[model samples]
Each structure stands twice: as structure tokens, then as C-alpha cells.
Target chain A: MTKPASSHQTLNDAGEFAESIPHEKLVRSRTAQAMLWVLLIAAVLFAPALLYPVFVMQLLCFALFACAFNLLIGFTGLLSFGHAAFFGGAAYICGHAVKVWGLPPLLGILLGGVFAAALGYVVGSLAIRRQGIYFAMITLALAQIVYFLALQLPFTGGENGLQGIPRGTLFGLDLNNPLPMYYFVAAIFLAGFLIIYRTIHSPFGQVLQAIRENEPRARSLGYNVDRFKLIAFVLSASLAGVAGSTKAIVFQFASLTDAHWQMSGEVILMTLIGGMGTIFGPVVGSVVIITLQHYLADIGSWVQVVIGAIFIVSVLLFRRGVVGELARMLKISSV
Target chain B: MLKLLLAQGMLGLNNGVFYAMMSLGLAVIFGLLNVVNFAHGALYMLGAFVALILYSYVGLWFGMSGFHIGFWPALILTPIIVGGFGILIERFLLRWLYKFDPIYSLLLTFGVTLVLQGLFVNIFSASGTPYPGMPDALKGVVNLGFMMFPKFRLFAIVFSLIVCLIVWYVIERTKVGALLRAGTENPELVKAFGVNVPLMVTLTFGFGTGLAGLAGVLAAPIYSVSPLMGADLIIIIFAVVVIGGMGSIMGAVVSGIALGLIEGVTKVFYAPAANTVIFFLMVVVLLVRPSGLFGREG
Candidate 1:
């Protein structure tokens, strides 16, 4: 086994080379992400019969969740183990709004996103006080508290869960059918994905990336490191909430499983398996894992074992994941 | 009120034993290897299940079985077996990730947990297996006039204390202990001393994992051997580790018992919401002291 080298060696020594690159040129170069999103839209619009809308919807939600997760881990150099609080917490609120408050699906989704953002602000504010492993543990502890709250909350229906939620009208358009619902989910997912893409390409994204590469130097450069870290954390969590709320609408249910720590782990797995820091890797990962789940459902409990084995193999052999390594092989920097 | 407090304290002591064993292992692993060992819970679950299997299939008596092996043997054997598995893990999967991102270790161990839990579900099928306590030696209820408590509960408390002292003596007093401490600070210097740092890391992981296994063995009779028995418990122990400060063994032990009793008292007074009070305390503690109650400031 080779000795562990300092992280300084792996980073490019020639710094700020990409700092002056134009935004338009950067956007122009993302042909891969643009093409993938266009293809996804087309698939949603025309390929109704070829895919199970529910399955596709699930993939989109998880993909978005994974991407949101990557925002912290890949860009900010923070690994949060408590993302379930934002994701699942938002789902519960959205589900409750739609089912009980009788709100429109769009408004419900926004409400869910807002709730998660609020939670994200609180958790991120405190968690950012620590670095590395402590941050992960703090997030985890907070998420566990959310899980307990979900269990006891009357609106959550406890272990039985809040089920049979109506898809309701999407701004007066019925979304009860699978096709319309698929379109709605696809549109939301694409919008969220593009927002992430734009954020990653913008000046803010570069600063965050620099922080991930080296915090002390960024601090020396007069950056407000704490504020930047908190912003990244809250943004990642809010996006995860959007994904979770969308999932609740598609599945028409929200349960205790959403808040469980395992769900948080699953999101991380999706991100890692896809490619960290890559634009569309999480989407691909969600597709692969969701597809695997569909086919492997018959195996029941063994699925956990198989996923576990994949995780070990991925960390041991394919550390960069499918898209991260593939992007490198093709010399594509971002996507 | 005094009697209620005493009862809560006793229950807290019982719960503290579990916290000490599990969190002690986690601290050791984190200090030496800087890995959280997410699979610690799985290994603990495995120990309980192993004891259950031994009792059922091997006719190894512990509680209900005609032949009584008692808790002592189970404790020793469980850790030994669990520690052996931990050694294998350190040698194979965990060894490779020492140079990589710490998150990789977390992911790998999380996967290992899934596999272990899945395997148990496949074999045991969700329905819990029985785990009767030791022989009639400690079966009866002990009346303290104030509140009647089970003799087994008292035994569990005492046994864990004894184990904690022994482990503390070995880790805090021995010459090997000094070397282990030094290894945590600077493995390169320790390696120069010809102590074989890699071997020390492996042994530390094994020893830590073994503590978790021992906790499982003790817990078997207290709680049924189920697939999910250790999953939630480990999360609470993480809270304990965070509260105790991850670097100090003594802190882990003291905080574990203290928190457990605090939880127990919460159960007695605010029974409706006792389940989450420990977590609430953790959040408050984080706000007040992010490094934990016992952790040294950076």
C-alpha cells in the first residue's frame, strides 16, 4: 500500500488560471449537459410508453437530491450526513399542505422548499462552526432529531405515514395522470438542475470550489469563509428539499423512511456512484441505481447487501465514480 | 422524589454501560485511524445474533437453554469472534482507504452495515430471536424497599464497570498504551521506533470493534436479537461520542453513563417524549460546545 500523500500535491500548482474565463464561453462549452437535459426533456415529452413514469419521476427526484448533496461535498468540501432533515422534513410539510391544507401542487412544492431552506439555514449555521468530520456528525445528530420528530408528529401519521395524497391541480391543470405528472416532475428537475449548473459555472461557484481546494488560502485572499460555507450548506439542503417534495407528489406519500439516516446514506451513494463535482453525474447515478432497484426488487433484502458491495468496490477501485472518471478521460472539466 | 431519582439513576447506570462500551470503541478507532467505523453497530448486532445462534443451534446454554454458559463466557467469546472479523476488515477493505478521503471509509462501512443487516434479515427474518439471561443465579428481583430492581440489571451495571476499569487500566497505564497514544499523534515517529504502526492500527481497530461486540453480548438478554436492534442504538452512541468528546476514552465512559441516566430520568418524568430528549440535549450541547462537553478546544 502506498503512503497517504498530502492533498496539496493532487491540486494544480498553477492557480487562478481559469479565473478570467468568460461566462459565455464556459456556458458554450457545456454541450454535454445541455444535450443531456434536452434528451431528458424529449424523453419526458414523447417517450411515455417506453418508461414507467413513476420510476422516471423517482430517478429525477433522487438525481436532484444527489446533485444537491454534491453541492456541499464536491464544491464546499463538506460531507453532510444529515441531509435527510432538509429532504424529508420538506416532504412532510409539502405532503401535509397538499393533503390537508388543500394547496396547489406548485405552491406545496414551494412551501416544502421553503421549509427545508429554513431548516438548512439553522443546521448549516451551526454545523459550519466545525470542520470535516465534526460537521458530518453534527448534521447527523440534527437529522436524527428530525427523524424522531417525524415519528412523533401527529401530522406525519407516525409509523403508518401520510399516504393517499392527491396530486391535485398543477395551476388548474390536472396532474393525476402519469404523463402529466411526469412532465411536471421533469420540468421541476430540469429547472433545479440548470440552476445548479449555472451556479457551478458562475463566479460564486469558482470561489466555493477554491474554498474546497484550500480554505486557508481562500481566507488569506480575504474571503468570508464562514458565510460562504453556510450559504453552500443551506443551498444544498434547500435543493435536496425540492427533490424530496417532488418525490412526495409523485409517490403520493411521505413516511418515516424518508427521515431515516439510511436515506441520507443512499443519497451519498447516488452522488458517489455518479461522480462528485460533475454536472450530470448524479442524474446518471440516479438512473443506474433506480434501474437496478427496479430489476433487483425481487431479491428483497439482498439488495442492501448488493448496494453495500458496490459501495465498497466503488470506494476501493473506482473512487472517482462513473462520470467523474469519465469526464477526466474525455478531458471534459465540469460535466 | 428522592426514590424516583434513585430509580432513574440506576436505570441510567444500566444504559450507561452500553454507551461506554460502544462509544469507547468508536473513540479508539477515530483517534488511531480517524475512521468512524459505521459498521460498529452491525458488528454489535452480529455478536448478539451469534450468541443467540450458539444458544439455539449449538445448545450452548445461557438463559433458557438447559446447559448454562452464563454471561461471562459469552462476553469473552463474542468480542474475540467479533474482533477477529474486525481484523479481517482492517486488513482488507479498511486498509486501502487510509490514504483516501475519510468519507470513503464512512461509505464503505455504511455499505458493510447494509450487507450485515440484510444478511441477518435474510436468515432471521425480522422476527426477533430469544435471548434469555444468565442462570437462576441472578434471575430474581432484588428489593431495595424504595424500588424493586432486577438482579440482572444490577449485575449488568457492575460487570460493565469492572470491564471499563480493566480497559482503562490497560489503555491508560501500560507501556503499550503510551506507544498507542504516540501513534495517534505521529505514526511516523512511532514507526521509526520499530513498533510496527500498521499492526498497531489493525490491533486498535480490532480492539475497538471487540468492545462493541462485548456490548452486544451483554445487551442480548436485555433486548431481543433483532436485525434493527443495534442500528438506532449506534446513532444514539454517536451522540454520546460527540457529547463525551471523541478523543477521550474516560470522557466517553462518563458521558455515556451520565447521558443514559439523564435519558432514563427523562423517561420517568416526561415519559411521553423521553425518546428524543437525549438528541435534544445533544443539539443544545452542540450550540453551547461544538467540540463536545469534554473535548479540548482547537
Candidate 2:
């Protein structure tokens, strides 16, 4: 009984090492949890109509993108400046696969993830040699090379990009329809989000958090820091690819814009604005940013100006972000 | 063969001018503030626009009074104006974020880039704005027996080299340089010595930003002043900084010129793919020396 109690305590200590959030504060009542799910279901069922499906689809993609980004930043404490390479590269690959090879959408998306994962493994190895800002610059330089390659590569279709990608049928059900596609996107987003959540809560996740807090300590504890970081990078890039692939289907277009440096910056902005380490920050941030873009698309490049202002203000005044600050105030961790 | 070599050398020299000034600014800012300053390019773009506006409207009004203020005035004035603006930005935006991670400053500057770029595009309407030349003082070609070079471009090369030398001297040789270096390496100790570190940081930012503006003004006469000109050059300047390794001022100045020449030669040999060669070189540099060619391994 003492051994079991010791193990339980160790587990608790491992999970909440930094914050020491109380279990009571974390554990939601069954009724309250049920109420949350019901409200979410109602909102989905009633889904807003002015391009609601499109909006949700966009949010799903970018939320997954931010979550993927967070996998490196929050868990591994490595900030990648070239995440657009993974995201946009996968979009091109997935779009090219489905349209040119006539592969199923699921397989195509998986292939995209695989391509991005391979790239992550290679770039992550080189990037891990440096820490902090150097890592960021190295990643950015590598991503720029990828962007150049994408421009020259024939499969990417250069400047015009691979356009009119067929969404195809999902297990023989047409997802071309707006509402059905919305559900499909939501399911995928939820699945990706859950996978990330599960990863963060796993034994490996504990090791990663240890690494993030103090890598030397984790290394001393017999954890292979570099190996862990590489694997995390792969997983994050693969998930980003999943988002990019889904986005390719939703938009039926893959352009240089996807692979551009600015796209990378935009994804970073989304994650930072929403909250870096928090679970639901990406979702909220994606929703807010996407909606801003949607309504303000007519404002032209001022959108970038506005987003930049938000970035400065957010970093300077409100680094905790919307959901992050809320969770801090409530004294709970979402994931 | 000698003539062709000389021709290529001159072309490289012309490019060297742009790269030296741009990366010098980057090095200055990175050394003092530890910010990558993505807005450096945007500031350069604004400098060109300032010159254009001065040439178009200010020239017309001032010309009526027979004071022909040309590129000479812009070469001095635009930088002061833009540097003044940079001082404001440093005080208001960048100064507070100094205690935080350097990455936040990078993000803040990137935001500034977006705002500045947006304003430029809004005003300039996305097309190229051409600036007229000097009053026959330095135009046409100069023949140095082996090759003929554009006089304006040659002047630009000589002018930027002088500017780079002066900047290098200030950073490397002066007492102010010692204070700034001490502040950068360890601000707490520097502040304990009773120096106003915040003001130093702000002034350093202004100097770096003014360098960017100076490059813009010089480039306006040589190249078309377009909204996108800065974006096109910024990436190259970044490569130069990475290669130069931000630690040594001399390294920054030397590598900036070297990289510009390398890029120039690449354009001659492989014209179609010249734009991407610098980035590939960066990868190679990283693989070879991760701390960069001139950066110390810490």
C-alpha cells in the first residue's frame, strides 16, 4: 500500500511539477463537463451561417497548425521559425498526391504528414545543435531553402501552384458539400487536438515537460534530450501537415502563399496571440484571427499591420493570452 | 579575360555597397539590442519613399527658390528623419520588451515591419517610384582602361565604403563603443557604473535604423524605389548577418561585402537561380560553422 501511494505521489509530482495546481481545481464535476460538451454540440449544430462551414474549416486547420507549433515551443522549449515549410510543403504534397495520383484523401493526407515528418527529422537534427535565437534563425534559413525548392520543383507548379485539388470522397461519402465537410473538418481537428492532449499527458510528455523546464536535469535523469526533441519535431510537423492537407482540400488550391515566410509568421502570431503553452489557446486564437481575416480581407494589407500591432501589444502587455490568462486566473490546466 | 574580370569586379563592388550598409545596420542592432530587427528592411524602404516624396514635391517647391536640393541633401536628411522615427519606436515599443526574451523583440520589430510596409504600399500604390539623377555632376560611364563602369554606381560604392569605415571606426575604436559593448554583454554591471543604459539602447537602435535609411537613400538613385525593394534585399541581408556572426563589427562589414560579391558572381554565372543561391550558402555556412564564420562558440 505504501509502494502504491509513493508511485501515485510520484505521478502527481511528475505531471504538475512546475505549477502545483490542486487536483480539486483541475478535476471538473461530471455535470459541468457534460454541460460543456452539450454547449459545444449545440454551437456546432447551430453553426453560424455567413460562411460558417468555411470559417470552422479554416479554424480547424489553423488550430491544428498552432497546436503543432506548440508541441515544439511549449513541450520541447524549441521555437521553430519555419513551420510554414512543414505546413505548406504538406499542402503541396497532399494536393499533388490526391489530384495527380488519384490517391484517397486519407492516404494523401497521411503521405503529406509523412513528407513533412521526414523534413522535420532532417531540419530538427541540424537545428537542435543550436539553442534559442540561433535555432530560430537556422530553422528560418532552412525553411527559406525549402521555399526556393518549392518554387523550382515541377510538382509544386511553381508560382501558380497546384490548384483545383479534388476533395474526393471520404469512404465513398461526398465531402464536397459544405455542411458534411464542416463535420469532417471538426472531427479531424478534434482528433488531432486529442492526440496532442494525450501526448502531453503521457509518460513521454512528462519527460518532455522536464526537458522544457530544465534540459540538463532531464539529461542527467537519463532521458535522451536530442532524441526526444527530434521525435517531438516529427510529431509536430506531421500534425501541421495534417492541417495543411485538410486546408488544401477545403480551399481546393495550394499556392506559394502557403509556403511563404509570411505564412510562417502568421502561424506564430496565431499561437502567440492565443497562448503558447495552453491547450485551448490555439483554438481560440485561430478562431479570432481567422474571423479577423475574414471580415477584414477587404482592408487589404492593413490586416498585416493590424495583426502586427496585436503581436506587439500582446507580447509586451499580454503574453499570457486569452485562454492562457483565463486558465491562470482559474488556476487550472486544460491539458 | 582581364576586361571581363574587371567588369565583374565592378559589378560586385556595386552590390557590395548595398549589402555592406544593410548588414552593417543589422549588426549594429543585433550587437546592442540582440534583436534581429525584421523592420530594418521596412525602414530602408521608407527611406527610399522619403527621398521620392522629397524629390517630387519638396524639390518642386524648393526649386522655385533656386535651392536645388538633390541626392546630396537626401543622403544626409532622410536618415536623420528615419532615425528620429526609430528613436520614437525604441522608446515606445522596443525599450519595455528588453527585459523579456529576445524573440519578443524580434516579433515586435516584425510587427513594425508589417505596419511600415503597409503604409508604404498604401501611399506608393505598389508600383515602382523612380528618382531622378544629380545635375550632371556624376552621370554616364567612367572608363578605367580595363572596364567602363556607371559613374553613379561607382560613386555609390565609394560613398558606402566610406560610411562603413566611419561606422566601423565608431563601433570598434571609440570610448562610446566601449560603453555600448559593455552594456550589450552585461547590462546590469554597465548600469551599476552609473550610465543611462536605456538611453544608450535607444540611441543604438536609432543609429542602426539610420544606417538602413542611408542605404535606402543611396539606392534610390541607383535602383528603382519600389514598395517591394526592401523585402527583396532583407533576406539577403539576413544571410549576410548570419554568415558575419553578429559578434564582430569588422566581420559584419567584411562578410556583407563578400556575400554581395558572391551573389553578384552567381548572377553572372547562373543568372536564372541567383536569388536562391545565398540561402543555400547559408545552409552550407551553418553546416560548416554553426556559430557562423565569425561568431564565437559560447
Candidate 3:
């Protein structure tokens, strides 16, 4: 069966097919992409100056988190509902590592990523046992188990979480200052984004996309679909861990809020709003959502109501998402 | 020790009714729509809320604080109203997304879940208000020789079992159920046969969600009515669905109750593991049988 045109922009492409498109649109899209990158870099450099550095850091952290999530939903055709376990679980573990173990900030962050990878390996190994919606449900239930453990286990500090996490020096630069910390987070976000970009364009990524488009076809072609999916799942989880680990140090705290199912929902929202399957979608999505949250924090649950409304609208009318639609309008391969 | 075991088993059975009802509703919806109704839990919570309003707010708005809709009428009335909302959701929202990947429908229902759950939390804070509409006939305790059980809980268990049996019989043995099954297998063929496939789908969704409402009404007096009550339970139900597979009516019913009883037994030995024991079981089940115990390989 042919995939719907709106599911992802890449649905139009059938590799090794003889349909030749005009070259002008490709050049045009490339130029447009380059311009966007320049604009984004400029924004990152100047956003901290205009906005609170800490707030900018929060956006960066969530942006990276959303990107990691998009790698699954947007690229791999897997919609995991339990990403918060990696994000929040890492926050708690990284916090404990840096605070109690007195590890360097870099090492603690790495340790958090490793922990998330391991957690992802176990969760993903079982989750991949089922396909499609069952996969989503399995991940969600497993994550709920993790949340329960975080609440019940002694090290997670229960509801208060792992409080007073130190933002130790990374290469002699004290992380206490907002400016230095912002740059540090920016660096991590860039590294994570680049890794995702490279992965999506790599040979393995092509196989993932092949599986996403048609798993049976890919399997028939002698591909080991399950192993590929497990690896992709682990990759996404570790990056989410990096985002959460970085957040742990930046905020100097880890709490149940990060580990909660609501956080998982928020990441999904970010990916959907920005544009699923678009390279730059989740970054833009996270910025829009976090900014709305920052401004609307005082209105209480209304923010959630509004976000929910936005999600419903996006699903019904704008499934292409903001970046997805924009790229479609521009006839660009990338969002 | 045996008496305590029986009591816990009874309590576990009470919890199982909810699980069975919820998972059964989800399986029914998924069978036809190919959409995993993520909002099934929210709809269950809505059922309880509907019963609450009928019992309390409806009377209060009419300026009779003491006069309330009895526990009996509310039980019948709640599902119809909740089922109406389900029909509206199917007609308006769920109809548009059928041509796309099933995941989008899951996402859409998830959005609906957030909206319904968020609005309720806003109106009635997170802390649940206990339902006070239990009938006098079902209040207090009944001795079954081995243990004394709350009459309401006993009624809930029996009522749910009866409802489950009725539903199973209708689906497995009736002519209309044959149409529902035909529709699930090939809607286009069913439509060619002039069965009104879309209408069948809409009503099926309504019926499934109505079951959720019925379960909710049964649970209102047992647990405090709260917006947050459905979220956690839905995840567990999803696990039950995973373990039971989505295709089998009996599988949904049996696995849900069995897990609840297993959890109760665990609670007796080590209370801390009770909540997570089902999830671990799910993991083990997946390793042994990926398509679930009763599920055909997808």
C-alpha cells in the first residue's frame, strides 16, 4: 500500500525509480536550508542576550530532547510514549553521580548518557517484540514502571527528587554562571543535533527509513529489521539522556516532574508541532512550546488545556506540522 | 492466613473488574477502527464524572441539595451520555484520520485525552472527592463464611461479571455481531453488502466507550472520582492488552483478572512490588510469546 502523501515529505521518493524531478527546486531548497541554518546559529548566539540565559538553556535542553524523540517518530515510524524515563531517569542518575559521586560535569553527563543507553537497551529490547501501537504501549508501561521505581527507590529522593545537584566545572569553566552554562548547553545541543543529522543521512539511517516506509518489504530484502530498530532506539535514548543530564546540571536539580508521563507527552507535542520527520522540526517545536510555557506558567492548568487544543488541531488539520508544511511549500527535502 | 488470602483475592477481583472492562473496551475499539483509543482511560474517568454530576451537581443546580439522582438511574443514564460523547468524537474527530497511519489516530486520541483530563483537573482539582451515592442496599458488609466483604464491592464484582458475560454472548453469538466482525475484516466488502460500515464503526466506538462509562459508574463509590484516576490504570490496561493480545474477548477478560489477582498475592508477601509486578510479568510474557497468550502472530 502506498503511504499517504502527508505522513512525511519523504513519502514521495521511491529509491531506484526512474521519475526525474527538476533540478531548480533542489538547488532552491538547498539555499533555503543554508539560510535557515545561518539564522538559527545567529539566534542561538543572541537569544541568551535577549532572553534569560537560564531560560535559553531550558529551551536548548528540551530541543535536544525533542530531536531525540523525533528520530523515532519522525524517522523510524515508531512513536514511543515513554521517552521521559530516559530524560528524567538520566536527570536523577546524573544528579546523583555529580553530587554524591563528585564526578566532573562532563563525566557525569557521559555517565547519564550511558545509563540511559542501558535503560533504553532493556526497554527497547522488549518493546521491539511488538510492532506499531503495541510498541508504543509497551514502552509507556515500562516507563511507568521506571517512574514507580524512581518514586520508590531510595536514591531518587522520592517526590523532591535528587535535589541540590552541583553544576561542577567542565574543563575549568565554572558552570554556576548562566552565560558559561548556556554556552555549555548550546555545545551539547549542537553535538546531539549533528549526531542525529549524520545518522539520518547515513546508510543505517536509509535502512531505518526503508523499514519505516515498508517493514515487510525491507525484511523481504534481507534486512534485519529488529536489530536496526533496537540500535536506533538506543541511540535516541542516549541523546535524550544527554539532554536530561545537561538539564540536571543546569538547573542543579532533578525531580519527579522530569520523570513523569506528562513529560513524555510534552516531548511528543514538541515533535508534532515542529513537524515530524523534518530535520529541523523538533528544535523549532520545542522553542515554541517552552516559550509558551515560560510565558503562560502563571495561568495554571490553562496552559495544559491550550497545549492540548494545539495538539488536537495539529492532528486534525495540520498533521504536516509547522516545519513539515513549510518544507512542503518550499518543495524542500529537509524541514 | 487463608481468610486474609481470600479477602485480598476478593479485593483483587474488584480491581480486576475495572481492568477487564477497560481493556475489553480498548480491544473492541481497536478491532474495527485499527485505532488504539488512547483516550479510553479518559473516557472511563469521564464516566465516573458523569455519574458524579448526575448524583450531585444536577440536583444542586435544581436547588435541591438533598434530592439526588439515585444510584440506580445514574448507573443506566451515565453510559448513554458518555456513549453519546463517544459517538460525537467518532463522527467529528476519528473519522477523518482513518486513511492515514494508525499511529496518527493514537496521537489524536492522546490529544483528546489531554484535553478532557486537563479540563477536568482544572475544574475539579487533582485531589479526588469521594463518591457518596452508594445505595443503602449495597452499603456495609456481607459475610461469606470465610470473610466479610463490603456489599458494594461484591455488587460491583457481580454486576461487572454479568455485564461482561452479556457482552461476550452478544458479540460471539448474535447476527449483528457477525456484521461487526465482517466489518472488522473488510469494511469495503461489508459496505458493498449494504451494511453501513461507517455507521457500524461509529456505534461500535460508542459501545466500547459506553462500556468504559459503565465500568466508571461501578467504580465511583469504590474509589474517589478524580481526573487523574484513569491515566495510570490505562497504562496498566495497555499492558494487559499486550499480554492478552487485542483480538480475543476472552483473553482480555481473563488476563486482566488474573494479573489483578497476581498483584494482590504479591501485595500479601511484599507490598512494594505489587504495583510493578504486572509490568515485569508483561516483560516475561513478551519474551515467551510476543503476540500475547491468546494473540495470533501479527
**Which candidate has the top score in DockQ?**
3
iRMSD (Å), candidate 2: 9.2
What is the per-residue lDDT of model 1 for residues B248-284, given as tens digits with 9 covering 90 to 100?
7799889988888888888778785677777778778
Q: Which rank order by DockQ, best down to worst?
A: 3, 1, 2
Docking class of 3: medium
For model 1 chain A, the run of ten residues with the poorest summed lDDT: A1-10
Worst 10 residues of 2 chain B by lDDT: B59-68
The segments of candidate 1 whose C-alpha lies over 4 angstroms from its true place after superposition are A1-34, B59-70
Model 3: residue B291 alpha-carbon error in angstroms? 0.3
Model 2: residues >4 Å from true position, as ranges? A1-19, A28-51, B1-9, B59-68, B133-135, B144-146
Per-residue alpha-carbon lDDT of candidate 2 for residues A54-173, written as tens digits (9 for 90 to 100): 877887899899989988887777878889999999999999999999988888888998999998988888888776666777788778878887898878889998998998888668
**Winner by lDDT between candidate 3 and candidate 2:** 3
lDDT of each: 0.83, 0.81, 0.89
Q: How well does candidate 3 score on lDDT at residue A264?
A: 93
TM-score of each: 0.94, 0.91, 0.97
Backbone atom clashes (below 3 Å) for every candidate: 0, 0, 0
| lDDT tens per residue, model 3, B75-169 | 99989988999999999999999888888888888888889998999999989988888999999999999998999999999999888888888
The clash number for model 3 is 0
Cα-based lDDT at residue B165, candidate 3:
85
Per model, the share of native interface contacts recovered reads 0.66, 0.45, 0.69
